[model samples]
Structures are given as C-alpha cells and as structure tokens.
Target: MGVQWSDAADGPIGGDLTAVLAYATPAGGAVLTPIAPIGLRDRDAGRLTFTTSLGFGRKLDRIRSNPAIALAYHDRAHGFGASSAYVLVQGRATIVERPDREYLETVVGPAAARFLGAPRRGPFWDRWLAAYYADRVPVHVDIERVVTWPDLRCAGDPVVDGEPLPAGPPASQAPPKKGAVPRVDVAKGARRLRGMSDLLLGYPGADGRPWVVPVGLRADDPRGYELSAAPGLLHPGARRAGLVGHRYNAQLVGLAMRQHTGWLEVADDGSARYAPHTDAGFAAPANKTLLLLTNGFLARRGLKQAQRARAAEAAT
Candidate 1:
C-alpha cells in the first residue's frame, strides 16, 4: 500500500500493521520486538494498542517499571525509486487486563485478516480469532510524540541538508568543511556519548528484507559503538550496517561521518572496521556534541525571550 505524508492520527503508518517496539531493559540497554498493532486507535487519547500472548515473553514485566518507550514504523520501499518513510513514536505503554469482549472483537479480528492477507474474512476466520484471543493480552501505547521522515534517501548523503553549498569553483570538487570548534569531550558512561548516543543501523536480513537495528556509540572511543540488543538480535545474518538518521544531525556525529559508503562490514568475530578518521564518522562524535550544545543554547535563549514577552504582555 502507498503511504502519504500527512499530520493525521494514523497517517504515518499507512497500511503497515507491523512495527518495531523499543523499550528499556533492566540493565540500562533496550529490547526491540516485532509486533502487530491490533487496531486500537484512541485518537482523542493519543493511544495505540496491540496484543501478545500473556506468557510468551518478559516484555510485560519491563513495561511495569520503565514506561519510556518508542514504536517505529518504517517502510524502506514504496516502489518509488529508493525513497522510503520512517516514523518514530516516543510514548508510554501499559498492559490492560480483562479487556471487554467488544474491544477484543474490534481489534483482533481485523488484525488477523491483514496478517493472513485477506481483504475480507471468510466464515472460518471466527475460529482463528477465537484461538488468538485465548491467551493474549492488550498492551496500550499512549503516544507522547511522533517524528517522521517522508523521504529517507537524504540519510545517505555525505553533506547534511541545509548546510552551505560547496565553496570551491565548479571545475574542482571542494572538500567537505569541518566543524569550527574542537571535539567536545564525551562523559564516562556506557552508551552515553553526548550527542551520538543513539543511531539506527539498517541492513539486509537473511530473507533479504530490510532490517533496522538501533545502537549507541561508546563514550570512551568514538570509533567504536555497541548494539543495544545482541549481535544477532534481529537477524543472525545481518552483517552489513548502514547508519540512518537526518543528514544534518548525522553530519554532526557518526563513524562514517562524511564518507558515503554503500555498506560497512560487521565482523562475525565481534569486531568492525569502521570508516577511517578521514571520513566524518570518525569525527562525528565530537562534532555532534558541539552541535547539540549550540542547539541547547539557542533553545534556552528562545525560551527566555518567550517568557519575557509573556511578562511584558501581563504588565501592559
């Protein structure tokens, strides 16, 4: 199904029923799951719901403590060239027990139809729905914020969008400009590299389908990064890694900083030969931190100005 970019409640998802839910693990990492949303859209409440077998996993237990979560809907191809759409919904979730019969009927039945690739359910669908509801429980996701990129092609560009054009004469190619300031020091912590904390890596799974994994850069070494989950968490054979993010934000930090390569090989021996320092990826960690600090400063100034304007209006 084709996806249209709009500000609707469900516009970002298009006809995609599957999503990757990321939630915090007890040890400060994250766990990603492939789940099917069972058509629970409370537009007014800004919530979406899905169901999974009650005893099938330990994700329910993780939800009880840390509510901060993110659900992503990514369609790598819409048959429109290499263009794609990605949406991230940072939200909170909870498991609801003893749901009403009507709610179950409204959600589960249609989800099964979509999963089975049937436009309309036949007579036997009722039995399938009954079997699905036997041990599953609903997980409510209240959306806090949603961010989407209509075209992800820009993620591969060497220079970030909105930056100045090449400065040299047309005949010769100009080298990409470096950040003005020195690299900002990253604090000591696991997966806490100031501006380069989280990144999305995409590669082809064994089935040849596009697979994305989220990872964090090591604070101590900019060249190295750690996967939030296990090495083969999503797909055991996913070895080539492509970092995906807004081109501008990505320019500020990453391992492949400025060089745009087709794919970086991830070693099966738990090692990786990242792009050399000449590439922006090596310098990205420091540059990213500086950019973040600059953005923060500007944001604070804007907030203060807004506050002052409010006070002035009240005085008048």
Candidate 2:
C-alpha cells in the first residue's frame, strides 16, 4: 500500500523549500543531493515532484537506470511549513524528460514562484538563462513508504505509514574498484560540516533503494566522524555511502551545503563511522539576482558540456 500523507506529514512535504534527495549509484551506493520539491503534485495520491536541469545529465542518467530514490525533509527553519516532524519518503521516480513549454510556464512556474519568487524576465535575462529555464525535466515520485518522527531531531519512536521495510540491507554489489581512502583531510571536513543544522546519511537498502535518515556526529575520530542515529536505523556492516550537511535561510534565499561520498562502517553494536573519500560544496549567494546569475552561468556551461559529450558518443 502507498503512504497516505497525514496532516503531520503534509506540513513539511507541502511547504518546505528543499528536501534531501538520495538516488542509487551504479556502484551500489547512494548519492545525497538537495532539491527543491516545489510542492506536492497530487496530495491524495502522495505524488511528490521536483525538477532538474537537462544539464545534470549524469544524475538524470542514474535515475533513468535506477528509479528507486528517497527524499528527506529534515529542515524547517524557512518557508511556510510549521510542523516539526521529520518526514522521509521512499518511492520510484518517473522522469518527464520533455515536458511542454506550457506545462513549464503554467504548472511548474507558479509553484516555483511561491517559494523562489517570480522568475526574471526581459530579453537579456531570457537569452542568458534560456537553457536553465527552458531545458528542464520534472521527476515525479510515487510514494511507497513514509516514515515520520515526532520532531526534526528524530527523538521519539518513528511512526511509519505505508509499506513495510525489508528485513535487512540489500545484497551487496561489487566493491568499488578504487580504494576508499579519504581524499581530503578528515578533521577539516568534519569541522566544516559539524555546524550545519541538517545532516543526513544515506545508503542502499534491502530493496536496492536508497534509505536516508537524519544523523548527528557522535564523536570525531582521526579517520572520520562517528555517526549517531535512531536505534536500528544503521545496518551493521561496511558499505559505500553518502553524507550531506546543509543549512538555509527563509525561502532558501541563503544556503551553505557540503556533500561527501565515502565508506561507512557499522559495527554489530550499532556504532558507525564515515570516512569521506571526496568532498564538494557551495554557498549560494543571499542576493537572489546574484544567485540567478550564478545558476544561469553554470547551467549554460553544463548544457554545452553534455551536448558535446553526446555528440562524441554518436561520432564513435
């Protein structure tokens, strides 16, 4: 059975500006990325939607191959939501690769404006952001399960609504070819992420779908940060994993985020540690104009690169 969103789940699901999206990697790990889930596309069916640029070809490709994904709504410091509940939605994604312009302008545009303000117009802006605005794809998730905690901290026992979770972690895939050694200074990376308000850890679950949960740093080890989450949330074993730490102001006008992909070790006693192999992050400008400019520039560059890559593939 699908999850039926209760009033408690509705607040954050319908009003939060951003949610942490986790999608499976071919190597059997999960990559955590933050996305703006504009709003619930269908309340009764529990259909959630978000859009990404055509420029993000690699992520789009991953979703196309493995549709199972998860979204965690763990932050409530901004936007219209008033609920304190932390919600996690696990489902299958259906990507709308070439939605018509009318749908983009009428359906997606209005919902975006509610949270991001009106889109920039004029000939110069339009020409500058053509790819960013016009070349987008929407991904809709059909909710299979919903897990909620009483508050953002996930302090109380979770109340699950919908399908039952699998009994254990999924069969492990082949280990990544490369070694999982930390690529950056573990201590430096931990210090930078420790202050963020929302920290999430994600890994592949029993159904081969990604499972995400809010976690905190239990201790700072020389190799990595020890992780603490609700009891039974962390499966016992080592696996490829991802961690994201983020914070944002009202309407997502200002933000700082850090993401890392690495190896996670969970002991039989439930202790966990994450050693980051790679780290990447950014701080979005507080000024909307500057942010839009940055987005436009990046989108244009990414689109061009994607096109070139596609052309090269065809030439072979």
Which candidate gets the maximum TM-score versus the true structure?
Answer: 2
lDDT of model 1 at position 9: 26
Which residue pairs clash within candidate 1? Answer: 253-284, 254-281, 255-281, 256-281, 257-280, 257-281, 258-280
How many clashes in each candidate?
7, 0
Q: What lDDT would each prediction earn against the true structure?
A: 0.43, 0.84
Candidate 1 lands at a TM-score of: 0.44
Q: lDDT tens string, model 2, 1-316? A: 3458788988888888999999988778889998888775586776888999988788888899999999998877666899999988888999997787898889999998898788899998998888788898889899888888898877767788788778666554445577655667888888889768889999988877688988898777667888998777788888899999998776576778999998888888878888888898988898878788888898899888889988999999
Stretches off by above 4 angstroms in model 2 are 170-175
Clashing pairs in 2: none
lDDT of 1 by residue, 186-221 (tens): 123222323332345443333222234444443234
- Candidate 1: misplaced stretches above 4 Å? 1-9, 76-83, 117-132, 153-316
